[model samples]
Target: MRLENVSVRYHRRGPWVLRQADAEVGPGEVAVVLGRNGAGKSTLLQVTAGVLRPTRGRVVDRPRHVGWVPERFPADQPFTVAYYLTAMARVAGLSAAEADRAVDEWTSRLGIAGFRRVRLADLSKGTAQKVGLAQAMLRPPGLLVLDEPWEGLDAAARDLVPLVVDEVLAAGGRVLVSDHRNETVRLPGARRWTVAEGTVTETGPDEPEDVAVVEVAVPAARVAGTVARLRAAGHQVLRVRAAGRARDGATPGVGPRPPAADDTALPDEVAR
Candidate 1:
């Protein structure tokens, strides 16, 4: 997808949110948008997702099926979750039976199946966010645009974000995402796009940083949770080992040890 000379403003005389912004993301690629608050990140994403029209320029070759999840899901509607999802599925071109099946599949996968009968107005922010995610994914979209997808999500749901991105990319679809909490670490190799001063700039993938490895010993049961937390916090987990084997100094189930404690070593940061 490509945006050519795209610009946006709420009012004719108001300041421009994006001006002459040109960006592109090809199939099977992911772009992570970075910016400060009110830096036009969401505006650029809206234009890219086909949710809003550029006031002056135009977007070309946007996919027919676009999955857009805004920062906050509109959860104050009166409809029940199941009914809303079913309606959205139909809007996305699914047949009645297919809509039912899709609703069942996504709600189950996102762990909101039990709330199917609950009214949207009654669901919590996190659960409502899941519903937004589920609706966007009722069909495998050709372009997936997510704005702060990790907001209001629990650990399990947060872990699923990467899996969802992978699924879209694996299917040759493009992904555009904006994040403030540094959750993009889970999405390795995504292109970086920064929006500032009504301009959009694209950068290559992150350069390799000189990071020191820190070995963290955790109980067997907590190992998985620790690794997940580290990755989620943008820390690279060099390796994880079974505590039993590490106690015996066995090499089989052990990960590579750090080189040496140096200035870059951050044991305190990793141990938590």
Candidate 2:
């Protein structure tokens, strides 16, 4: 999707939250919005998700299925958790049977099954946040926008966030998220968008400075699997060297050898 010359303001003459912002995120890509609190990161995400119309420019090519989870869920609603999600599923065009199935599946996956019958207002902040995530993902979305998704999550839920992102990416969906708790370290290789002073700037992909590269030797037959495992763990594989040359230009073996059970040589996992 593309945000061309986007801008926003609450009132006709109020201070602009975002001004002349331009950005884009393609299929299967993830863009992490960054800034101090109230720096308009949410505004940019809203525009990207088509939840807010830009005061000036426009968002083009937004997907038909856009899953949006706000910073705080609207727990003031009278509906129960199950009722709200079921209603949202229907709104997303699912049939009665599909809605029920979806509600069950998502509530189970998000660990909110115990609160299914509880009213929205009765749930705690973390439980309500889980409901928010479940509703947005009632169906597979082409663009998933999450604003401060980690605000109320526990340790288990926090870890699940990256796995959820991985599923979306695997399905060729785009993900846009705003994080304040440094919880974005798990989303390796995501592009960064900084919102500040009523402006949005794309700072390119996230690349951490403190990093070390390690070499792993695997059999020719296991090379692909090893690389895939490394990448899934958020480690970038710089290159696949042949058997003749090691990192220090020394020969380690004559040909590829079988990898040991604990063959991994990666010291640390970093962003792509």
Candidate 3:
């Protein structure tokens, strides 16, 4: 899927959404979109999923199309949970019997089988979100666009979010998700696009750990080289402590231990 020069302008009160931007997502790849609220994150997903029309530019997508889980799903009618999913499948053009089968399959997968006949308005927010998610994945569209799919989900449903992600990839589907809350996902070789101020940039390496620094005692002559190597290896460096100074401040009997007896020579930080 490709979005070329896609910019959506809401009104004359200056731009409230996305600016001219380009993004390409490929099958078998999961691209997590990160941004602050009102940064056009949800707008972008809607455009990608063909749910919203852009004021300018165009979106090109492969056949087998896209699936979407919006921040809000339509369930205001007097329909049961199963009935709602069946309606979505029917809108996607499934046969009546086929749609019912699909609805049964997804409802069971999402653990909402017990609530199948329950009214959508009576279900909790988390349960409603599961129904929305199941609707999005029932046919495994070529592109999956999600806007905070994990919102309001219980712990168990939240745990299955990654599994749903894996399913999309397993079906050779590409995904673009706007995720908040600093979710830690291990998407190997996945591309990250950070959306801020309506511009998207692929971020580089993440920040380092929060451990305190204790200097490594090294030959002064090699200190600079050693520190450089350590930084390259992703370690935070602090001021070096001289070996002589260490001995000078040692607790009385602790000074001048032989190498064979110096089992505590290395500090815990360095040992690990």
Candidate 4:
């Protein structure tokens, strides 16, 4: 999908919030929109999601099924969580049975299954955000747009955002997301789209930083689990290799070695 020379403003005489913004997101690609507060990031996303019409230019080749999740979900609706999601699923072209299954599947995936009977207005902000996410994903859309998707989500829910993005991309869909918390690192290789002064530009991928390379030897069976634990703790593991045979028949485990004089040391906990 592409935004072609789009320009938007609230009124005819009002200043434009987006000035001739031109951008494209291709299938299987994730674009992360970045900008300071009030820099028209939300407006650009709204335009991409087709929630608001552009005053000038057009959105071309947009898919019929586009899912949009706003930064702050409008949870003041008078419907229960299950009802709202079911309704949204039906609106998205799901059959009655499909809608029921979709609502059930997503609520469980989002950890909101316990709140199915609770009204939207009564749910906590984090829970409401989960509902918003679940609704957007009722059907695998051709284009998925998210604005501050991580806000108000708990740690587990926050971790689920990237998994959803990956699912869409893996299924040959496009994803466009706007975030202020520099969380794009979670979506590795995502193109960066920066909005500034009412203009949008695609920036090149950031260069990787230099860091001390650590090689650890672990049992082949434990390599996967060990790497996951290290990465979860914010340590970058360069690689893992099979331990060489010990001449004395001792069990080989990863033991810390002192850092070189010019190299920075790993954290104490990690080293141990």
**What's the count of clashing pairs in each model shown?**
0, 0, 0, 0
Q: Go through the candidates in order and give the C-alpha RMSD of each one to the true structure.
A: 6.0, 8.8, 12.6, 7.8
- Cα distance off (Å), candidate 1, residue 213: 8.2
Per-residue lDDT for 214 in model 1? 58
TM-score of 4: 0.79
Number of the predicted model whose lDDT against the real structure is largest: 1
Alpha carbon deviation, residue 97, candidate 2 (Å):
1.6
Candidate 1 stretches with Cα past 4 Å from truth are: 207-215, 220-229, 236-272
Q: What tens digits encode model 2's per-residue C-alpha lDDT throughout 1-272?
A: 88889989989999999999988899889999989988999888888888888899999899899999999999999999999999999999999999999999989988999999899999999999999999989999999999999888876686678878988999999999998776776777799898889888886675656776555677788887887677556575655766654434445654345445698754355434
Identify the candidate with maximal TM-score: 1
TM-score leaderboard ranking: 1, 4, 2, 3
Residues 1-272, candidate 1: write the lDDT tens digits: 88899999999899999999988889999999999999999999999998899998999999999999999999989999999999999999999999999999999999999999999999999999999999999999999999999999987798788889999999999999999888887677789889999999988777655556456666678888888778767786654655444433346555435444564544432321
Q: Which lDDT value does model 1 have at 118?
A: 100
- Pairs that collide in candidate 2 are none
Q: Give every collision pair in model 3.
A: none
* Candidate 4: tens digits of C-alpha lDDT, residues 1-272: 88899999999899888899888888899999999999999999898999999999999988889989999999999999999999999999999999999999999999999999999999999999999999999999889999999888876787789889999999999999987665556776688888988899986556655545556667778877886677566564443545566434444564444346888754432221
In model 1, pairs of residues that clash are none
lDDT (CA) for every model shown? Answer: 0.87, 0.85, 0.73, 0.85
Q: lDDT of model 4 at residue 24? A: 85
